[model samples]
Target chain A: MEYFFELLLSGLTRGSIYALIALGYTMVYGIIQLINFAHGEVYMIGAFTALIVASILTMLGWNEIAILFIASVVAVVYSMAYGYTLEKVAYKPLRHAPRLSALISAIGMSLFLQNYVLLAQTSDFMPFPSLIPDLEILEPIAHLITTPEIAIILTTAIVMVLLTFMIKFTRVGKAMRATSQDREMAMLVGVDVNRVISITFIVGSATAALGGVLIASHVGQINFYIGFIAGIKAFVAAVLGGIGSMPGAVLGSLVLGCAEAFFTGFVSSDYEDVFAFIILVVILIFRPAGILGRSDISKV
Target chain B: MLELKNIKTFYGNIQALKDVSIEISEGEIITLIGANGAGKSTTLMSICGIVPPRSGEILFMGKPIQDMAPNNIVSLGICQVPEGRRIFPFLTVAENLDMGAFLRKDKDEIKRDIEYIYELFPILAERRNQAGGTLSGGEQQMLAISRALMAKPRLLLMDEPSLGLAPLIVKQIFEIIKKINTENKTTIFLVEQNANMALKVAHRGYVMETGRVSMSDTAANLLANDEVRKAYLGI
Candidate 1:
C-alpha cells in the first residue's frame, strides 16, 4: 500500500509536467488545426535558456529566487519569440495548403531545430540548477511528495486555472474560440484571425518553455535531445485527452504519467513505450474519440 | 453608402460575379436576388472584402476600400452575417454575440448592445448561456443577425438569412430586418434566393444569373417584371 501511494505521488508529479507541455500542443492544434511539430524544440530552447541564465545569475552571486525568476522570464520570452518566428516563416505560407504538406514542414522544422541546437551547444547533457529546495513532506516510507513535485503540481494547476479563466471570461479568449470554430465567420465579424493565430503559438510555446524549465529543475539535467521524447509523450497526452479540450489534456497527462510509472516500476523501464502504445490502442478501440472527446458531425 | 463598380469575382477558373455594379444608399435596404450559384452571396462578400473583385472599385462612404482586410473593413463600419448562420458552435449565445463586437473598447456600450440584442431576439436572450450549436435553425439565424448587430455597423450585409427557416420564421426575420433598418437607419445589403420576400422589403434590387448582373431596377418594378417573377418568384 505504501509503495502504491509512493508510485501515485511520483506519477502525479511527472503528470504535472506532461500536462503543461500537452497544453501547448492542444492549444495550438485547437486554434490553427495544425500540429506544431517544432513545439518540442521550444521545450529544448527553454531548458537551455534557463540553464544559461541560471548559471549566469549564480556566477553573479544572485540568490535562488532571483535566479529562478530571471531564468523563467528569459526562457519564456525566448521560446515565445522562437514560436512566433516559426509560425511566420513556415506555417503562415502553408496556411491554406494540404495537411500533409504542413505535417512534413513541421517534421522538417523539428529536425532542423534539433541539429541547430546540437551544433550550437555540444551534444553533452548539461546539469541544471535546482530552483526549489528539496523538502520532503512524508516520513521515509519510500514515498512522499518532494518540494519539486509539489511545486510542479501546484504551478501547473495554477496556470491551468488562469488559462481557463482567460478563455472563459476574456474577450481575446472569446475571439480565439470564435476563430477556431469558423475562421471566415470570425474574420467577417472583425477578428484579426492572423493575430489570434500568432497569440495561440505564443501562449503554447511559452507554457511549453515553462514546462521545460520545471522538468529540468526536477530531473537536474537536460540535453538537446531532451525535448524529443517529452514532446512525443505530451502529444500522446494531448490526443488521449481529446486534442482541443483543455481539461482533457490534464486528465490525459495524469493517466499517461501513471501508466508510465507502473510500467517502469513493475514491468521494466525499456517497456514503458510499449505499454504506452498498447494503452493508446486499447483506449482508442474502446473509445475512438478519446475519454472526453465529442464526436463532431460536419454540417453543410 | 456602399458602391461597387465593374466588380468581377472569380473562384479559380469560374467567375462568380462579372462587372456587377450597384449602389446601396445609407439608411436603405437593398436586396440581390438570383438562382442557386447566381453570384448573389458573392456580391455581398465582395462589398465586405471577402472575395475581392479582380478589377473594379468598391467605395464605402465615398472612400475606396477595395483592398482592405475583413477586420479592417468591419472597423470601417461594415459587418457581415454570412450564409449558413456561422455562429461559433462551442460558444454560448452571449459569447457569440460578444465576438461580433470584438473590436469595440467601450464596455458599457457593449453591455447595452448585448441587452438590446436580447430584446430584439428574446429567444436568444433566454438561451444566452446555451451553446450556439444547441439552438434551433431559426433561433440560430436570429442569433446570427443579432451577433452582427452587436458590432453596431453602419452597413450590415446579410447572405441567405432565410435559406432554411420555416415560412413563419422567415416572415419574423424579415419584419425584424425592416425594424432594424427604420430604427437604426443601418444601410443593408441583402443577398437572398427568396425574391418575393426580398422585393417586399427592399428599396432597390439586382438580379444576377450565371455570374452576371442580368437586371437591375427598383424593387417594386422588379417584382412586377415578367422575367423576375417567372424565373425567381415562380408567379
Candidate 2:
C-alpha cells in the first residue's frame, strides 16, 4: 500500500511538470494549428537561464529564497522574449505560407537553438540548485513525497485554476478563445488577432519556463538537451488528451505520468520512455483526435 | 457613409472582386444582390480589410481605409455578420455578444448594450449560458446578428443572413435588419442571394455578376427590372 502511494505521488509530480509544458503545446496548436516544434527549446533555454541566474545570485551571497524567486522571474521573462521573437522571425512571415513551411521553419529553429546553446554553454549536465524550499509541514511523510513534489502539484493546481478563470472571465482570455474559434470573425468583431497570437506565445513560454525551473529543481540536473525529451513527452501528453483542449491537456498529462510511473514501478524502469511512446502510438491509432478532442467537422 | 472606388481583390492568383465601385449613403440600407461566387462576400471582406483591395480605395466616412487591418476597421464602426454565422462555437451566447463589443471599454454601456441585445432577441437571453454551436441554425443567425449589434456599428455589413434558414426565420431576420437600421440610424450594406427579401428591406441595390457590378438602382426599380427579375428573383 505504501509503495502504491509513493508511486502515485511520484506520478503526480511528473504529471504536474508535463501539464505545465503540455499547456504551451495545446494553446499554440489551438490557435494556429501548428505544432510549434521549437517549444521544447524554449523550455530548455528557460532552465539554462534560471541556472545561470541562480548561480550568479548564489555567488553574490544572495538569500536562497530571493535567488529562487528572482531566477524564476528572469527565466520566465527571458523565455517570453524568445517565444515572441520566435513567432515573429520564423512563424509570422510564414503565416500566409503553407502549413508545412512553418513546420519546417520550427524544426530548423529548434536545431539552431540547440546548436547555439551547445556552442555557447557546455553540452554537459549542470547540477541544478535546490530552489524549491523544504517545508517542515510534510517532514513526517518525507519518504512518500518531498517538498518539491508538493510544490509542483500545488503550483500546477493553482496555475490551472487561474488559467481557467482567465479564459472563462477575463477580456484577453475571451479574445483568445474567440480568435481560436474563428480568427476572421474575431477580426470582424475587433480582436487584434496578431496581438492575440503574440500573447498566446508569451503565455505558453511563461508556463513552460515555470515547468523548466520546477523540473530542474526536482530532478537536480539539467542540460540543453533536457528540453528535447521533455518537450516531446509533453507534446505526446497534449496529443493524448486532445491537442486543442485545455483540460484535455492536463488530464492527458496526468494519465501519461501515472501510466509511466506504474510501468516503471512494477514493470521495468528501462522501458519507461518506451512505454510513453507506445501509449502515444496506441492513442494515435485508436483515437487519432485525442481523448477529449472533437473530431474535425467544420460547419459550412 | 462608405464608398468603394474600383476595388479589385484577389486570393493569390484568383481574382475575387473586379473593379467594383459602390457608394453607400450615411442613413440608407443598401443591398448587393448576386449569385453564388459573384464576390459579394469578398466586397464586404475587402471593406473590412480582411482581404484588402488589390488596387482600390475604401473610403469609410471619406477616409481612405483600404490599407487598414480588420480590427481597425471594426474600431472605426464597421462590423460584419459574415456568411455561415461565424460565432465562437465554444463560447457561451452572452460571451459571443461580449466579443461583438470587444473594442468598447465602458462597462455600464456594454452591459446596457447586452441587455438591449437580449431585448432584441429574447431567445438569445434564454440561451445566454449555452455554447453557441449547440444552437439551431435560426438561433445561431440571431446570435450572429445580435453579436454584430453589440458593436454599435455605424455601418453594418451582412453577408447572406438568410442562407440555410426557414422562411419564417428569414422574415424575422429581415425585419430585425430593417428595425436595426431605422431605430439605430445605422447605414447597412447587405449582401444576399435571397434577392426578394433583400430588395424589400433595402432602399437601393446593386447587382453583381462574376465579380463585377453590372447595375445599380433603387431597390423597387431593380425588383421590377426584367433582367434582375428573371436572373435573380425567378419570377
TM-score of chain A of each: 0.95, 0.98
Each model's fraction of native contacts: 0.92, 0.94
Runs of candidate 1 with Cα error greater than 4 angstroms are: A136-142
lDDT of residue A246 for candidate 1: 84
Candidate 2 second chain TM: 0.99
What's the TM for model 1? 0.97
Best by TM-score: 2
Q: Which residue pairs in candidate 1 collide?
A: none
Which regions of candidate 2 deviate over 4 angstroms?
none
lDDT by residue (B1-235, candidate 2, tens digit) is: 8999999999999999999999999989999999999999999989999999999889988899999988888999999999999979999999999999999989899999899888888999999999999999999999999999989899999999999999999999999999999999999999999999999999999999999999999999999999999999999
Which DockQ value does candidate 2 get?
Answer: 0.92
lDDT of 2 by residue, A1-300 (tens): 999999998998899899999999999999999999999999999999999999999999998889989999999999999999999999999999999999999999999999899988878888999998888988999999999999999989999999999888999999999988998899999999999999999999999999999899889898879989999999999999999999999999999999999999999999999999999999999999999998866887
Extract clashing residue pairs from model 2. Answer: none
